[model samples]
Target: MSKLERNEILLLFDVDGTLTFPRTVIKPEFEEFFYSKVQPRATIGIVGGSDLEKMFEQLNGKKILEKFDFIFPENGLVQIEAGKEVGKQSIQEHLGEKTLQRFINYVLKYLSELELPIKRGTFLEFRNGMMNICPIGRQCTREERNMFAEYDNQHGVRKAMINALTREFADVDLTYSIGGQISFDVFPHGWDKTYCLRHIEKFHNFEEIHFFGDKTEPGGNDYEIFVDPRTIEHKVETPDDTRRILTELLGL
Candidate 1:
């Protein structure tokens, strides 16, 4: 297809599990295939819950901005197009200091009281549009992360925490989403992955918008956009699944 023809269809992907293993850099071979084979077929973009710096570290460092047509970091609260930031939002500004402090204090107290298989530091991470809450902590090693994932799968630890948060902050307009293996995110009601759709719509009238993500189930980070009417959702279990689906769907 010609460049213009290809640009008419936008292929949006999630970063962590959809494009790369969580908290790791992209594989060299997959990166080659994605840029050479996949990029030639459609206008590609990435919408990740991570901040831009983390996305860059996992995707391809700072050069990632130039490689993708659109980059929606922090669930599109920070929008970058053509390697330039076009829009941005702040959660601290939206939720006043009093409310933010109350939420933070409650979370810290909850974490301190809860027991886990193992715990580490940096349990709560503040971001541009959300806070990432980690039960075992984000500083865990890869083996620790995988172990926690397995344990949480059986115990539903993250789910339980999210439920508690929902109940405690019932009056607050906050959304809790489980993403990756270790943590969940807390943001304003509409600041999920679907938030990127608005920014994408402003740029072009694409014939189709395809979103590929691993965490597409209810309460997962990808749930909103995956189920949205504006997107053709492909739920993948890993980066390899994402590649296979892309090749089969687009004939790449």
Candidate 2:
């Protein structure tokens, strides 16, 4: 692993399985610990496969938002920079509403046409516009969830069907990033999870940005970032292991 000076480090954590354990249960326990570690941090953010509204809804305490400077929600397609939402006047400089609306509408229409049952976990997974098309289209049962796990083992990476979907919608300027389970992301050419880190780096001036994810293989999203040390990184495994690594490498 690479090292960072503690004083200069900016902690950006991916939610879901990384920061929170019991990955399926987005509950109070995880939020409680999240608040405990994050409240005092000056520079931090939450980068997850969720929209801003969904992220806020899942938040366990007010303190989580009170402390973090940004929420790179919807992948890198949206950003809540320095405590400001993506739209509104102040934060409008980096992203545009027209583009977002087009993308959002396209997705909405696309999914509506499919007319799948939309439920918790059954909806799209996105952050900063890093979008994931869940196989079941929403939340599912234990048995149904296995399909995604199976998908990864058999058809994941850049060549998977999800990747083909991006190609199918090639007009949208999309790309694929294999995420957890059967989830796969569709976002702009340079704006995947790794790009979110790089975008943050460009704006914030970081020496390096370290990433972590449960998925990494031939077509894994973080694979490219993991190989590069200058702007991005991809850690393979649980958040606790990630924490252990940061503790030793950066003396955090």
Cα TM-score per model: 0.96, 0.65
Give the alpha carbon lDDT tens digit for every residue of 1-252 in model 2: 344443345666666556654235445554554455433432566776556665665564444556677677655456677677653111123345665566556655654554322323555654434556665554676566665466546644324455446555666565676655656666666665565665665667765455655554555555554464553454646656655654565434
- Residue pairs clashing in model 1 are none
Q: In model 2, where is the ten-residue run with the lowest total lDDT?
A: 86-95
- Give the distance in Å from residue 214's predicted Cα in candidate 1 to where it truly belongs: 0.6
Q: Which stretches of candidate 1 lie over 4 Å from their true place?
A: 1-4
lDDT of each: 0.91, 0.55
Distance from true location, Cα of 248 in model 2, Å: 2.2
